[model samples]
Target: MINKLYFTSLDEQVQQKAFRAIEEEQRSIGYYTLPDQDITPILSYCDSIPDMIETIAVIGIGGSSLGAKAIYEFVKPLNNLSRKLYFFESTDPINITTLLSKIDLEKTHFLVISKSGNTVETFSIYKYIYSLQNDPSAYTFITDPDSPLEKYANEINASVLHLPDNVGGRFSVLSTVGLVPLALCDIDIQALLNGAQTIKQSFFNDGYLKDTLLKKAVFYAKNHAQFHINCIFAYSETLKYFCEWYVQLWGESLGKHQRNSAFHVGLTPIGLIGPKDQHSFLQLIMEGTRDKSVTFIKIEDFHDNITISDITLPHLETLDILNGLPFSKLINMQCDSVMEALEVQGDIPLDSITIPTVNEHSIGSLIYYYELLTSLVGELIDVNTYDQPGVEAGKIILKKKLRVLKK
Candidate 1:
């Protein structure tokens, strides 16, 4: 996995600096928040049978919704839960209506998440949902204890969970940003945290050779200068939202300039369901006009297993053809073979990230690793990943436009 030359320019010093920053950030804010840890109470609240929850809705914009969405996609199929998980962050009325139509009002529960409690998009959705139910208590709030949403939750007699003030929304996944909703869905929060801790130790430990976050930033700065696009092609369907989470991370963090240079960091995320993408976007990816870097994510193992017997084959006396290979081996070999072909073609640069397994710790590690890598890459490109100054401008402009329209 480390042989890829996409990051040839990254030196030991650059990597060390990146690692130091990641360690500092983790030290500063990591302990300030708790994610799947201390989540037993939340899970207990959701211990009711599946049939009782006709629908589960999560409401928040940007980081709040995106991280939860990523977790939902990553862990949903594994749990085999019967109820549907719906997200209500989008502004489209049709999409909101379609989701509402499927939910049973009497049995459904809404989890409204917003760190500040007053984000325009999030509050707008909360109002819409409130109008639908005509009872604020029907919704639960996850935000800062002092935020307006917390007060609103109290006023409506709904349940409320407080988010850590020091942790930013994008970095809140390790906190209630992701854990609460996931717990409700019966996901193993403990396992996810364990994975995260593994990643954390890997970054902080001195002897580790591969600093994924640093390598990621170096690769992005170099590749973006050449290819101008960074695409995350997650092989598993469950990881589709992982791409989305990365999109916000990369775009918001690095898409700026420090020294007033003409060039600005640019990255576009395109989620590809592998094996599936081999049919759909592979052609454009291989032969398209744009220069692109692709990151491929694969889970080393899945929670479920399936076996097919050779004896069931229709072909007569086919034992010799299928004698040696196991089904799991065959599937993995096929994927590896495809990757080899892509490498041989040299159509684009690629990175392969294999997860030993997906759980809370791994997820935490993945998030932290990416966050650290992003910061390093942003620093390299002279961009600020820590702040979203551009986003606030849009909000200010929108408020002024709204006032004008009201007049």
Candidate 2:
């Protein structure tokens, strides 16, 4: 599972812990709070998909797309999908054009996901794709009812899936936003939800505050003042997307505007893939700044295994030691080496969450783990972790600028 550590140091004033108790009332632990009794509707929908549906163009951004994308990346290589998946995550023309070039409009099905029906990027991409066909039956919208997307879906005769009022986009990973995309791709939504259920049962039943995820959040909360940056460095490429998913969960949840007498609270989240990042950011992490905490995600078992055969470099005997070494061993060794140096040598604060294997169960647990962790941390800081008012402000400014451009 996940592991963590925390400590305090000083030369002067006070050494008291400076973190608020999480308010249970102000919390929206939707992922765990809500039980997923049956997914037959989701399952049946995927089962009934027409054969012509070849590509599933996931149309959403941020929480809408990130979790689905993360799950697809992790599960795609397993060849467990009904349709080839594509994502139109942003308004960028290159992304739209690049994906469009490869997809067949006649064969492609659009899964437009937006918690708030009026997401500019989502509908913008939707309209762009819609313009090519004008076929309402080809589009499926996942958003709140009475929202713009819902109205548009009704007008165009496209299918509509509703997101619950309690579940926000970021926390909607277990909901239809993620499950639909994954189910359409032929991934086991039940297994994913089962993993979520297992984790949820263990999480709350184990003891709320004394839970494992909570303890990890506590370590982070205790260090929020000094070590403000939380670096989640993944050792596996599969987890690269998961890092993106996590930062958003951490940054948006804890970054409050006004709290504790005008004290702004937030942890800067940094994501990295390795041993590739060793060449670039390793030096900075080792010596440059001690203001960050590092957590490495190491996978114990890998599906693909390759070993270096007997290599005869007669002149270079030093390189001979690499022979018979599995690529898995090499990566694991690198992680161990860097962690030893960072902790033993630099005294840098670091820990690792070792996933025994990369599979549906493990990935599901990881998602639930962080989802719980972020919510707990939000409670610790006494901040409303579910809302993203700051993001709304940026959207408002962009709309104002666009309105001005029209004038």
Best by lDDT: 2
Q: Can you write out model 1's per-residue Cα lDDT over 1-407, one digit (the tens) per residue? A: 12233334547687666656655665655442353257666676666434566677888888888887887777676668556678888888898889888888778888889887888888787788777686654677899878888887787788788776577787677777777777777667777776665555555564352455566676676567677677666656777788788888778766775656766566665667677778888788777875787776677776645655545445666564655456545555655766777677776787777766655555566666676566667766766566787888998999999889999
Give candidate 1's error at residue 163 in angstroms: 1.6
In candidate 1, which residue ranges exceed 4 Å CA deviation? 1-10, 27-54, 207-212, 259-263, 303-334, 358-364
TM-score list, all predictions: 0.83, 0.92
RMSD of 1: 4.0
Candidate 2 to truth, TM: 0.92
Q: Residue 27 error for model 2, in Å?
A: 7.8
